[model samples]
Structure formats: C-alpha cells, structure tokens
Target: MSEPVTLRVLGTSVTLLESIRQRAEEELGIRLVYEIHNVQQAQRIAVMQPERYDLYDQWFHNVDFVWPAGAIQPIDIRRIALWDEINDLPKRGRLHTSDKLGAGSLPSERLFVQHDGKLGSQPTERISMLPLTHNADSFAYRPERLPDTLAATEESWSWLINEGWCGHIALQSDAAIGALDAALALQAAGLARFENLGNLRLDEIDQLADLLIKKQHHGHFAAFWSDDQEAGRLMLDPAVSIQSLWSPTLMQLHRAGIQYRLAVPKEGYRAWFGGLSLSRRAEGRVKDAAYAYLNWWLSGWPGAVMARQGFYISNPPRARDYLSAAEWDYWYDGKPAREELPGSDGLPLIDSGERREGGSYAQRMGHISVWNSVMDEHNYLVRRWNDFLRARKAA
Candidate 1:
C-alpha cells in the first residue's frame, strides 16, 4: 500500500483550524500539515520559501506581495468544480452594480492570469487564488465604557483616535491592515486626508506617521496587537476601551461574557476576502491534492463552519444548505437568532434574539469603506509604522 500524500499548508490561525485538518485528512485520504503563523510571519514564509507550502491560505491583498514574487501558481478556473456557483463579488468586484468597489485589491483586480503573465480583472481561465471566506470588520467597544456625549452620537471610526478615548484605545499592529484602519480614523477625525486610502503615497505615509507619533506622545493607545489572540487579550484589559477587531475575536469576547458591541461605523467597515492558492512548487500528485483541498473548502462544510463564525463564504448559497434554516436566517439573512446559536467551537455564543450588528451579509458587505490592502508605498509605511511601534509615550 502506498503512503498518503502529505500536503503542507501555510497561513494564519484565522482559517487554520485543527478540525479542518482532521476532516481533510480523514475525508481526502491525505496527510495535511498546517504551518500556522501570525499574518506577518506567514507572508514572510510565503515569499521567502514558496516551496515550503503546497497551498497558501491567505487574503487577496497578499497577491500584491506574493504574486510579484512568483510564489503561487494561478489556479485553472475550469478545474474548480463549482466555479459557476461562485458569486459575482469576487469575480466581477461587486454583488450589485451599485455596490462600491472599496479601496484596495478586490478579488477581481488580481484574480485573472492575463496573457501578459500578469494578474488582472479581465475574464481568464487562470486565477490567482480560490476565493473562500470573507467579512466586513469594524472596531468593538464596551458601551458602558463610552461617555454619554459620545454614546449619543452615531458610531464612527474617529473614535479610535478620539482624544476622549486616548489611553484606553488599541489598534491592529499589521501595517497593511492597521495602517488603513488608522487612515480611516485620521480621515474621520479631520486629522489627515488621502487620495486613495488603499494606496498611500510616501508623503501621506509620513503625514500619518507624524500624526500617530504625536498621538503616541500623548499616550493615545493602550496597545497595538498583531494577532487575534493578542487582540482578544487587549480587549479584556479594562484600559482597552475600543479597538479594530475581527469577527472571531468579537465572538470570543461575547463568549467570555463581555458583550462588546461591534460598531457599525458611519465611515463603513474594513473588508477582506481570504482564499487558497496553489504553491508554484506543487506538481503531479501533490498538486492534485492541493487542488483537492481548495475545492474541498468550497464544498459547503467548511464554509458552513466559517459562516457560523461570522464569515461569508463565496458560494454562500451552497453553504446555506449545510446550515439550519434558523442559522441561515440569523447569520446570512440578518434576522434575529430565533434560538441560541453555537459558534464555530460548537458552544452557544450568539444568544436568542441577537441580530448581527450590520444586518445581512449583503448589507454589511455593501458598506465597505476600504478593503484590507497592501498599499503602493507599503514598505515605507512599514518602516515608519515600526518606528511608531517602538516609540515611547510622551512624558
């Protein structure tokens, strides 16, 4: 008897679940190994050693870095068993024509493998990655921690940088995503403006750094976190009043009994779509297993699991079948939960009568102010951002 093929996957913990690994190994007859790292470390590995992973599970914005490095092979659209069922958002860039293409790398923008050997939005047989889970994200806060004056006003991104919240606030630490979060807060507070929030220029990057440094001097932040666990721990600190957050972290907070409100910011939420890409080094049997894993993600079960955790999967309707009518109604349809709903961990997290803060998947997805992005001036932004990270609080 032949040994099962061992397929190595590299990504952040966001989607690298032990359950998924177990099921894939059991169902696909392959030994699936996951190298889970923080987003920054995972990207470094993806670029520094593309041969190390058979499949890369990451966000579309990563194409900005990974594609140019020739780390991943374009997936053949024809080979995707349910390609036709995939929604228009990733393919055409919006769910509806009127839907705004939020600033950054839309799945469509870098999806296709053009004739010139570059990725583009044009329809093509080859795609950079297989679109999988996505979500619209915003900051979470304790309503009791908010002052009455601020509580009365509609929620806004400016709250992150609001002087009133200084010394009680936090931010995501990743330059690619956190910089955009900071930019939105800065723009909302009238502190700075930009031509494209998704693609910051060098001067604009410095402008943000200058302002952020001043804020640091004033002790504006309680923390800056780089991963989900850190973000959740920061949220637990009474000193951390408000911070940009991902859905899973929010859900974990709820489970911990904090009931932190995920703000529907007036400026809209930051959005991101994550997917799987075949490694350039994968070939023959290993490559087949890689494609199998990609296809397996969209096969309804995993999408249903992500859906439970507040992510919308590409081809949601397919995943919908795997969920109960009430689950679909609450998670995707934006209706109140008719009964207590278990989170991805199979524990009850969303209580009965709870409605998703941003309403239905369509409503939430429609309000993206920006997508998680790797800006044109990303490297310079990182250098300055790191400097800010290392800076001391003002006396």
Candidate 2:
C-alpha cells in the first residue's frame, strides 16, 4: 500500500543509480526506487521544492553559483571510514555537510587534494558537496601532425602558447578565459611575464573580439566546440590536429579507436572535481543506505575502475589495490590507439577499475582550487569573456 522508498537523486544517469540500487538491495538488504534529475532541475528543487529530491549529485567549483544559494546540504563525514580513503577529506568536508563518499568504482579517482594552506589541519565545516569523482584537464594532439622532436615538457605551462601553433588549434569557446587565467598564473609565479593583462582578463566580449580579430588575420583555428563531443569529433578527423581538452572527452574518442596523445607541455596539468551530497531532509535508513553505498565506492574497486579509463583518480593507492598492472600501465602510460582499451564486458567501461577484483587507488596532488573569496572572480571573468568574443567577431 505504501509507495516504495523513492531515493530521488539529482544528477547522474538513471542507469548508474540502477546499478547502485541493485548493489544496495543485494548487499545491504534495502529495497529502494531511484530517480535521476538534471543539475539545473536539482538546483531549483533544492531551493523551491525541497521535497522533490532526496539526493543531489553535482560539481562544486569557484565559478558555479548554485551551492552558495542554499541549494544543497553540507554533509558530515568525519566518522565515516571511507573519508579516510579520500586524499582531500578536509576540502570535501568543507563543501557538503552530508556528502562523504565517491560515487561508483573508478581508478582515475584516487584521492582529493587542496593546497589552500589557510585551513591548516582543521576539519572542513561549511560543507556543500562531497566528491563523487574527479578528473584532470590535458592537451589532446595528433602525433602525426606534431613535428618530430617536439619540445613541450610537463614541468612548465608555457609550451601551450607557442606562436607557431597559435591559429592551428581549437580552443574552448566557453573556456577561452582559462587561457588568460593560465597567462595570469605565469605572471603570479614570476615564471614568464605577459603584458596587457587586458588580453588575459576574463571579459567575454573582449575575448570574442580578440579571437575574431585573430581569425581574420590568422585563419588558425581548426574548429571551435561548444561541448566536448564536438571537440572529440574534431580530434578524430586527424586533419584538425591539436586542441586543449579534458581527459574524459579524450577517453570517449579513445574508445572509438582514435589516436591522440596527452601532451606533456611545459605547464603542469589542469583539472577539476565533482561529488555527491545528501538532501537536508534525508535521515534514518535512507541515510544509512547512502553511507553504505558511499563507503563501498571509495574503498578501491570503483575508484580504480574510473581511473584506468582516462580520468585520474583522487585516491591512487586505493585504486591500485583493485586495478591490475596492465590496466595501470594502459592508463598511466599506454595509449588507447596503440593497444586495446579493456572494457567492462560490452559496456563502455564507464568505470574501469570495476574490472579489478581487489584494487585500491589513493590520491595525489597537494592543492585544489574551489570557490572561495580569492577565486570568486568568475563573474568578472565571464563578463569579460563575452565582451572579448563579441569584439573579436566584429574585428
């Protein structure tokens, strides 16, 4: 007579939750119905219709404006065993009072890290969301197009802006401001100085204006993508050559038998993370079930599954316990085009570490950047970018 316990989670696909639900039911003896909602819809439900969703899965960042608006609960996970497996426990704790674990098994997600230095060793209190999984940003290039004896090294960031490749590559239309951000980092670190921060400044119109001018004079951009799929299409063409890319997008291309390399440019890797959080109203069995699900996901198996697929895990050591040597080599050093990327049977291997029987991967990296007072300038950045794009188009 009563409705089945509906665990409405905002974010992720229905298929993902179905897997979790099946596991929870079989492993934890809990029968639950699951529903998936989009991030935008989840935000509105969290604020306007609190009763709608029992959970929310999404990303937390300096530029994303949803969390501060009271759209989700900050979880408390200090007592949870899985929290110990996460490298960035303090930072994740700070974001969501209720989010305490990663979602699914994946290798690329080892541990979480944040180099704020301001927090010292204190446990984070103003929680918003827990990291479900994370990924890094890297360059995707066709080896055939690059000159022999390429000089880009992974230790520095300057190799990306070489004048020779200026117009030939495709840059993200939405992420154009990131180029300027990288340039600013160069100035901040006293590595290399670039004048006219105006060019680097995040003014949308200004960025558009600059790009338009460049397009007229250079005819360099092979193509521009509004989303990752479009970018992947360009990469598969081979004729399009190189582009700034996120590893997940590259993974999809790799699965399709595409040949591309993760550039070890002079600059270090660029990346971001996302996580899961509970609704403020969730309690009792639902909460307990969620916690159980969270713990199983982070303890190694799921973490390794995600990592070997391209996205680097936040907890590497834990994932290593689950992933095999071959899987590890394939992810860390092996190229998908050069070898067959193992799959989870017929599935796309959405989470690769799942293939590992008892793998565990841990985290790496010392610092993470989240939305904070100093990094809260994305509004200005976005506005400036719009201006840059508009101006560039006119030019």
Candidate 3:
C-alpha cells in the first residue's frame, strides 16, 4: 500500500474530513492523513514548512503570508473538473459588478497568479487557490438579556463595545479577524474611524489596541475564544450575553438548545472566503492525490454538508444538486425551515418555522462591509494585539 497523503487544514474543517475521508480513500486508492491548526498556525506551517503537507485548506486572506514564502504553488484551473462553473464570485472577483452579476469583490483578487509569483486580479490559467466555502459573520446575543426599554432598537455591531454589555462579552482571539471586528465596533461606536478596515494603518491599529486595552481594564470582556468549541462554551456561560460568533458555533449552540439571535448588524457583515491549495513540495503520486481531494470537495457532497451549517459553496449550482428543495429554501432563500434541520454533525439545529438571520447568499455577500484580511502592517498589528491580550490578562 502507498503512504497516506497528508493534508493540513483549518480546525473548523474537521467535518469535511470526517465526511470525505472514506470516500476519498475508496475512489483514489490512497489513504489520507489530516493535521489541523488554527488559522494563524496554519499559515505559518504552509509558508514556513510546505514540505510537511501535500494539500492546504485555508482562507484567502493568508495567501499574502504564504505565497511569498513559496509554500504553495498555483493550481491549474484546467485540471479542475468544474472550473468554468465555479461561480462568478471567483471569476470576475468578489468586488466585481456588472449588469448581470451584482457588486462584490472580484474573485480574481486572490485567485489569479501574477508573473512575479504574487496573486492579482487578472485572469490566468494558474490560480493561487481553488475557492471553496465562504460566508458572512456577525455577533449573536441572548434575547432574554434585552432590556425591555430598548426592545425595538435594531441590533448593531456597536453592541460589542456597548458599556451595558461590559464584562458580559467575548471576542475572537485571532489577530486578523479580531482586529477587524474591533475596528468595526470602534467605528460604529464613534470611538475611531479607519481608512481601511481590511488593512489598518499603524496609528489606526494603535488606537484600536488602546481602546481594547481600556475596555479590558474596565472588565468589558468575559473572554477571548480562539475556535468554535471555545466560542460555543463562552455562549453557554451565563455571564456572556453577546459575542462574535461563527456559523458552526451558532449551530452548535442551537443543537444544545440554547436560544440566541444572530444579529444582522446595521453596519453589515464581516465576510470571508477560503479555498484549497497544492503544496509546493507535493509531486508524483502525492500530487495526484491532492488533486483528487480537491475534485472530491467540489463534487457536491461535501458542499451540501457544509451548506447545512450556514456556509455557501463556491459552486452553488453544483451543490444544489445534492440538497433538497426545503433545504435550499431554508439555507439559500432565507425562508423559514420547512421542518427541523440537521447540522453538519447530523444533530437537529433549526426547528420548523425558524428563519436564517441574513436573507440570501447574494444579499449577505454583496453587502459585505469588509473581508477578513492581513493588513500591510501585519507585524505591527501582531505586536499591538499581543499587548492588548497581555493587558486583558493583567486586568
């Protein structure tokens, strides 16, 4: 038997592994081994240690960090089975707008490879990554904690830093996302305004960091969660009434019978997209296995499974083939569930008559306020982020 092909993937993607492992082995005649890491750690390994993994599944935001290190090579779109049908999001760019397709970032922003080995928004046979799953994110709040006097007020990202919720809130600990969320909250609260939400200037980062430190000193945060499991635990805590939330964590909370509302913040959602990439070192049979895995992911089964948990597959039309009409209406049309729905884990999550917070995939993604990204001053941002964390610990 051949040695198993190794894949380094984000921790949240364990469900994909569980669902596809056996099928991949059966179809490709190769065993698969997975190594999971948090977003930050995954980037470090992909860029600093490409030889360790044959395939990498990660967010597009990290391409800037990893591509420069030559950890991953461009993917040949011709090799992708459904390349042409992969959605206009990755073709024209997420921010692209036309009479036919609505406004959003051009998918080519990170998809196409440039002559200098960097990524660009130009069409090329070579692509930095194969766009996979994406979604908009917002904070969740306990409805029971709502003060009756403010019952009719619209939920806003401002709630994250609202003095009333001080010491009863949590934030993501990942620097790239955490910083962006904090910046959004600060701007919403009129604390500071950033010129670029995705890439903060040093001064802007310092201002946000200082505000976070001050909030920590005032006992504003219940905790900082690094992953979905921790986020779910924090939501279950009585002290935590509101916090940044991911779709998977929200589903997990619902499965546990916890009642919460995923807020559609007036400012809009923090959107993100992730994809699959081939390692620079992957060659021979291992390289073939890597391609096999990527093809399987886009084959619709895994996409259908991811869709159950609030993620949108890059190729929606393909995934639609595997989903029921009721599932499509509930997940994609923003309609109430026709019946109880099972989550990625096969546990019941949404009850009948429940509606998704954001309307449709197009509506949510089109209005993306900012995409998750690493800023131009990433080193400085990391230092300030660490300082904020230390301040919180001291407090």
Best by the lDDT measure: 1
- Tell me the tens digit of each residue's lDDT in model 1 across 1-395: 98899999999889998888998899999999999999999999998799899999999999888899998888998889999999988988889889888887778899899999998999999999899999999999988889666967899999998888879998999999898899999999898989998889999999999899888988898899988889999999888989999888976698688957999999888999999988899999999998888888889999889988889999998898889988999999999999999888878888999999999988999999999988877889999999888777966
lDDT of 2 by residue, 117-218 (tens): 121223554344555566535456766666444544332333344444555566565532244434433443454443343223334334434544454354
lDDT of each: 0.90, 0.48, 0.79
Point out where model 3 deviates above 4 Å. 1-16, 95-107, 148-150, 393-395
Assess the local accuracy of residue 202 in candidate 2 as a C-alpha lDDT between 0 and 100. Answer: 36
So what's the TM-score on candidate 2? 0.65
**lDDT of each residue in 153-220, candidate 3, tens digit only:** 78788889988787898999988888788888999989998887777888888999999998888788
Q: Each model's TM-score?
A: 0.98, 0.65, 0.93
Question: Which ranges in model 1 have alpha carbons more than 4 Å from their true place?
Answer: none
Q: Where does model 2 exceed 4 Å of error? A: 1-4, 12-52, 62-64, 88-121, 124-126, 147-163, 173-227, 281-289, 314-318, 329-341, 344-374, 389-395
Candidate ranking under TM-score, highest first, comes to 1, 3, 2
Candidate 3 overall lDDT versus native: 0.79
Cα RMSD for candidates in order? 0.9, 8.2, 2.6
Pairing residues by index, what is the TM-score of model 3?
0.93
